[model samples]
Target: MVWRPTLPTKDNNVRLEVRKTYKLYIGGAFPRSESGRSYVVNDAKGKFLANASQASRKDARDAVVAARKAFGGWSGKTAYNRGQVLYRIAEVMEGRHEQFTLEVAASEGLSASKARAVVDASIDRWVWYAGWADKLAQVVGSSNPVAGPYFDFSLPEATGVVAVLAPQDSSLLGLTSVIAPAIVSGNTVVAVSSYERPLPAVTLGEMMATSDLPGGVVNLLTGSASEIGPWLASHLDVNAIDLCGISDAEEARELEALAAENLKRVRRPAAEDWSESPGMSRLTQYLELKTVWHPIGV
Candidate 1:
């Protein structure tokens, strides 16, 4: 007798999953690339996952405009208030813990438990940066001694519209490490997510939208770093750039040359252990020191 495949039954059913269209996060809203372009994103196993917006040079320019517009307000907020907002972001991320773990696992090809650990560490890293928002002034700023009857002081201030390149390998954790430090110090940012593993960064943009953070304080673009990096590095309005995600040495050198035209603060890429302690370097890199002199009586 020949065996045949079983027929569908009422108790068994197949449902189609709703796939998400990953778009660019700009000015606290999700918008498709103005270029009307998109690229296919794949899972670690090389299976089709979804489509991500391929941001263009125009998108990079728009992101810079948004960051510049939001700088004054975000930097003006009290340090304690900024700390509270950062902490709130951690709370929201905790609520979406499972989703982040799933995305990280697919993006990095890690086991479920390891992804969970990374997610947990990302949340903790946010909290750690939150705690520093209020304390950074005390730690980095100082009262200077002068021979005259005047008081001299040096204080750290936000560097204004910073552009960041999120790390390629450690998507979530490295992304968190770079972003938290910059924003905790009140600098607005336009960040380019990893080209290969961008899902976690898109998820992060969602959390930022729900949290107490203001629009345009952090703009995320999902596309090629090579395409976006040069524009941001050379943009006249941009104040600084973190080149942590640029893997090509030649490309990095070229970008640095462009940044020099505007005298932009360039943070060169280096081998980083994302899981280890992130000291004050990232926080201080995007900050400017302001010195003041005042009469002792005044």
Candidate 2:
């Protein structure tokens, strides 16, 4: 006797895990690449993961526009208010702990415990930078005694739109370390995520969107930085470029030259461990010293 195969019904319940499709985070929205192209992501062992939007020159341009638009309101916000928003981001990120741990483990070929440590470090990094929001100026600025009867003060100010090439090695921790410093000091960012492992960055962007942070304050793109970095380095509206993602001396030098056209502040990549305490250097890197003079005999 032949037996017939039957499809599963309510009597035989089955569930399927839903997979996620990653997209670029621009202006607080997840948008497909303007070029309408995408590349597949894989685990450390070459297993399929998902497709990530492959950002192009046009996408870079759009991110710059978004960053520029956000500069005014973000920079204008009180330092205390900015600190609150940053703390909110840490809260949201904490709620997504399991998700980040799983992704980081797969992308970086680490065990669960190791990945959790990275995730924890990233969240704490945000908190550390948040505390500096209200105190950065005090630590970085000073009053000077001028020869004349005038008071002179030098204060640290946001340098406007900054483009960051996030470190590719430590996808989560390094990315957090690079991003928090720039935005914590009131500058908005357009960052390039890791070319091979970008899922964690997209998840961070999601947390930022819901954390009461304003749109475009931190735009993230997932693609080849080599393809997009030149446009960002040369962008006239961008006031600075963080070259932490670049390791090659020749490439870093070339981007530095491009940034010189507009005299953009360029921070080259340093060989350091992201898991260690970052100190105050990152806070000072993207800041500009603005000196003001006031009459003493008023």
Candidate 3:
């Protein structure tokens, strides 16, 4: 049974519970969105225990500002330092199993056990991505050759601000897939969550906010995907778009076209295979082909 600390009576229960409200976590601090908006998060029983931000375009801009502010610090850190920070996130996720299972159950409308599974899987996903931070450079990257090389090489660099359309289903894993690739390769992302599955996204945000991830590395926004998906596609600030969860070919095409305006890296949706495939492939989708050149001297 979920623990209820002392069954609040008809008296102070009202006062004590009133002090609690789920708030959006931004920039490593839990603060009400500057827009000051909230929407209800309903449980499977259709009861509301908390509210989530109706994150606005203003919120998006604020997130971009935060990401920009944090970028130098995060991206400047040594790759191993970045790896350690990313791994710390998984450590934080480890200690919050009960809370994750309960909140995920409420948000996704799944059975408690199933919610537990998703939460556990999500934590493992972070560990998977964490392990990739320092290693992706070595694995997906390679030295370049020239006619007379003095030593030339290129490494994958961040694609700048990326916009993510989180999965329509499998909320947690889907978001993890999208965000992991972007951040692991050094890109920053502003994610539009699955409208129905936004709860876990914010929960993941809560973990990141507290887990030593520089703020804005992964900004989570929950809203009309159809509405914002295209907007983000054409957003001047966005350098790449990952349309992984968009199953509709027409919509995907439309979004891809929008991304073309700025030549943003576009990753089209792929066939779903839960069996086994290297998830590191997410890093390759947005990786840029930068080439360094040097002339051989006599």
Candidate 4:
């Protein structure tokens, strides 16, 4: 075997952008599951940059279990406490705003200004949802009038465990768009981030871990959507699913059927112009109703 150039004879002055590698941020510390599996994350040019875990079905199950276990306290948190915690997430997002802009630009091929807008939209989403934590009842619901002498009032409640298929195409905007709404309404989530752009998701997890979020409120898993989506849909414990950015109608329908097995609540695929101004439609999907009535004698 003959070797050629081992040293730099000429300074080509080549400066290539290197991708920052990451591991699955699970249960707080970044542990690569017992399976010890990883898959490649590529750049916009389709060049392999770093590895993301191929979180197995078992990983999905475990994440569901963690979310379930934490649901009691998280769902039980007072609206004020919940709002405080959710607001803190926006604070962390503010600190990492530039980091998200840079990562989104590289992976999603967005220009600097557009990527910055995307990051801003994501941060603002958190704050928007934060405002709803305590006030959704006043906005989307009201007391009902019965024919009898009784009182009837209806309001939203958390729907146990929600499995979210975070939007696939837009990295920061889509991921935050799905996740913020789910958690802000007091639902726990096991979200699969945009496969092509998971770095921002992992970074978001780190943000939550350090923020005031209680353990296991939001779990982020990175892997094949096709491989993992069905398991979450069919899992008996998963109370609902939101397939916001599925690429095909057939696959979306198939997942919907699986969710129907347990009568899981599903938010239909909508073509809402997420690029437009953000609003309360996302806030309503994750809500459940808790109606109370009392007999009144006049």
lDDT on C-alpha atoms for all candidate structures: 0.95, 0.93, 0.73, 0.83
Cand. 3 TM to true fold? 0.85
Question: Would you give me the overall lDDT of model 3?
Answer: 0.73
Note the residue pairs that clash in candidate 1: none
Over all chains combined, what TM-score does candidate 4 have?
0.89
Q: Which 10-residue window of candidate 1 scores lowest in summed lDDT?
A: 7-16
Off by over 4 Å in 1: 1-15
The C-alpha stretches of model 3 lying farther than 4 A from their native spots are: 1-15, 18-20, 31-36, 44-49, 245-247, 271-278, 295-297
Steric clash pairs (candidate 4): 157-288
Cα shift from native, residue 108, model 4 (Å): 0.5
Clash statistics: count for each candidate: 0, 0, 0, 1
Query: Per-residue lDDT of 69-168 in model 2, one digit per residue for the tens?
Result: 9999999999999999998988999999999999999999999999999999999999999999999989999998899988999999999999999998
lDDT score, residue 106, model 3?
Answer: 75
Q: 109 in model 2: Cα distance from truth in Å?
A: 0.8
lDDT of 3 by residue, 66-96 (tens): 6666666766777777778777877887787
| Model 1 clash tally, residue pairs | 0
By TM-score: ranked, best first = 1, 2, 4, 3
**Candidate 3 collision pairs:** none
Model 2 segments more than 4 A misplaced: 1-13
**TM-score list, all predictions:** 0.95, 0.95, 0.85, 0.89
- lDDT of candidate model 4 versus the reference: 0.83
lDDT of 2 at 82: 95
